[model samples]
Every structure is written in C-alpha cells, then in structure tokens.
Target: MLKFFRSIRQRLFKQKKFKNYILYAIGEILLVMIGILLALQVNNWNEHRKSKGTLKSTLKTISSDLKRDTIRAGYLIEIIELNQENSKAVIDRKVTIENFTTYPRTRSLVTIYQPFDIQTKGYDILKRISEQQENEKDSLFADLTQFYSLFIPNIQKSNERLEKVVIGNLEEFQEFPWFVDWSQGNTTEEMIAYFAISEDYRKKVAAYNVLAYGNHLQLIKGYKENAKHVLERIEKRLEED
Candidate 1:
C-alpha cells in the first residue's frame, strides 16, 4: 500500500501538478492515521477481552471461597447452638444429679471450645488484582473490600471476644476435682456434686455460651448475605460480558 501511494506521488510530482500532489499526500496521511487508529482500537479490544477473562476467573474463585465460608459458618453455628443448649440445661437445672450421671455427652459439651474460622485467601487474590489494575475502581471492588477487610475482621474480633469469655469461665473451675475427673471420662457422683456446688461458675459459662451463640448466629447471617450479594454482582458482570 505504501509503494502504491509513493508511486502515485512520484507520478504527480513529475507532472508538476503541485496542487494534486499535495492533495494526494494529504489523503495518504489520512489513510495512515486511520490504519494506526484501527490497529490501536483492535489492541484495546484484545486487552479488554483478556481483562474480562481474568476477572471472571477471579470472581469464580471468590465465589468458591464464599461458599466454603458459608458452609463453615453453618457448621460453627451448629456447634455453638449445641454448646448453648448444654449450658442452658445446666443453668436452668434441667439436668439434675440423676440425669447428669447418665448423660456424659452433656457434661462434655460444656468443656468444648470451638472457634470460628474465616476464609480470606481468595479475597487476598482479588485485592491484589484490584490494586494492580488501578482503573478497575467500581462498586464491586468497594463491596468486596468491605466484605473481606471490614466485615470479616469484625466477625473474627467478635469470635475472639467470645473465646476469651468462655475460656475465662472455664479457667475459674479448671482446678476443681470434678472438672478434672469429668474430663477423664469419670462422671461420678462426686463430680455431679462438685458441678452442683459450682452453681455460680455454671451460670457464667451458660451466659457466655448464650452470648457466643447469638454472636455466631449474627455473624453467619451477615456472611451469607454478603456472599449472596457478591455472587450476584459477579454473575451479573459475567452475563454482561
């Protein structure tokens, strides 16, 4: 194409048609500019396509992480509920000395401490990608930041507080003969007597377990909702692509 344009300009120049030559030169310049613009537009489109592909993969991984989080949260919530129920039975005198000797699982439940686990590795990847692509600043990124950075940390902190309360309550009666013997699969009459004698500690444990259960329930609800919103946003974006 360049050779054809050069040949035309040479012929026009040889003919001494200066005006026509100038017009031909201008047309050639315009064609070159148009070609360059087209090439650049194609490159931009390619880059945009690659970016969308990457975004889709990242979103899929994040969705997987969120699903795992929901499952984990649900499991932890069940454990908390069981612990809470056990504590309530003891606190409300529902489990008397007779039944306490029979049901060893109820006694075991009081001594268990299960902590909430947060999933963040997928979010970490998303954060890194968002940071590298400075132009990708939108509501999706904002929502992701809030969910992974703020919301998750808050839930973890609440879990930590719950742990401290439950552990502190346990420590108060850790040295008791009943506590030690009960831990060793010996729920004897003496252990029951000791448990009944420690009414104040039992109340504290029960109260803390209730508080932990409530906190966990709220956290799980928030996590599920946030995951749902994020999944919706990701699916919508993918569909638009």
Candidate 2:
C-alpha cells in the first residue's frame, strides 16, 4: 500500500504537478493521523472493558462479604436470645433448688452465654475498595459507609461490654472456680449453687441484654440494608451490560 501511494506521488512529482502533489501529500498525512486516532480509540475501549470486568469482580466479592456478615449477625442474634431466656429463668426464680434435686437444665445457663466474635471479612473488603481508584461514583459505596457507620461502633462497644460482664466480679463469686474449672464433671453442680439465688444470675443476664442482644439486632438491620443496596447495584450493572 505504501509503495503504491509512493509510485503515484513519484509520477505526479515528475509531471511537475507540485500543487496537486502537496494536496495529495496532505490528504495522506491526514489519513495516517486518522488511523492513529482510531487505533488509540480502540485501545481505550479495551482498557475500559478490562476495568469494568475488574469492577464487577470487586462487586461480587463485596456481595459475598456482606452475606458472611449477615450470617454472623444471625448467629449473634441466636446467642442473644438464648442468653435472654436463661437470664430470665434465673432472675425470675423459675428454676428452684428442688429442680436441682433432678438434673437441673438451668445449670447450663452460664455456659450458654457466648459472645459474638467480630467478623472482619466485610471490613477488609471495604478497606480494599477504599484504597482502589475505581467505582468512586457508585451509590453502593454510600450505602456501605452508612451501614458500617451504624453498626461497627455499636458492635465494638458490645464486645467491650461482653468482656466486662464475663470478667468483672467473676473471681469474687465462689462459683467462679467451678465455672472456670472444666476439669470436673460437677461443673453443673457449681453453677446451680451459684445461680440458685435470683439476684446475681439475673444481673449478669441483664448485662447480656444491655450489651449484645440489641447490638446484634442493629447489626442485622444494617446488614440487610447493605445487602439490599448491593443487590440493586448488581442488577443495575447487569442492566448496563
């Protein structure tokens, strides 16, 4: 192609058609510039396509992370409910010392008071997203921020309260040794002796209520909101595709 154009130019130049030759040369230069522009546009399109794929993968990761958080929230809710039930039983004196004459189901109340462990998966994804340069305009980011701001601090606070409730005055109670001592099968007996009184057991149960239960509920609510937003974003991206 280049040789063919050069041959035409040589013929024109030999005929001394300088004006037409210059016009042809200018047109040739224009064509080359246009080709370069088109090549650059295609390159840009490929880059944009790659970036979109990366963004979609990130969104999928975030979706999975949110689901994990939802599961954690549900688990925490379960623990809270169980704690509430046992605390009420111990506090109301529903389980009597006579109940201990039999195998007291109430004795395992202290053992059931498990705390929620902070889930870091969602937090890690969020941090990664923040560090990246892409997807700055996505509304999902706003939803994520709102969700984390709502629950993260509260969850942290609840964890602190759980530590306090489980540890504070734990050594002062005579049953603490038995509770901590898992070596003996008589652990249930120790629990029964300690919680037979309504006052102390109820207070610890109340602490669970004050700290974990409400926070778990709040976290679940936030997770749902975030999940909903994420689903919407996914749908929108699919539609755009």
Candidate 2, residues 139-163: lDDT per residue as tens digits? 6666666666666677676666666
Candidate 1 local lDDT, 1-241, one digit each (tens): 7688789999999999999999988988898899999999999999989877887787778878888887887787777776676667767767777667554446554456566677777778778878778634577877887778767777878778767775775686587767777656676676676555457646665667666766666777778777887888878876887
The runs of at least 3 residues in candidate 2 whose Cα sits more than 4 Å from the true structure, single-residue gaps closed, are 1-16, 100-136, 167-185, 188-191, 225-229, 232-240
The clash numbers for all candidates, in the given order, read: 0, 0
Q: Residue 163 in candidate 1 has what lDDT?
A: 73
Worst 10 residues of 2 by lDDT: 103-112
Q: Which candidate is the best by TM-score?
A: 1
- Best candidate, lDDT-wise? 1
RMSD, each candidate, Å? Answer: 3.4, 4.0
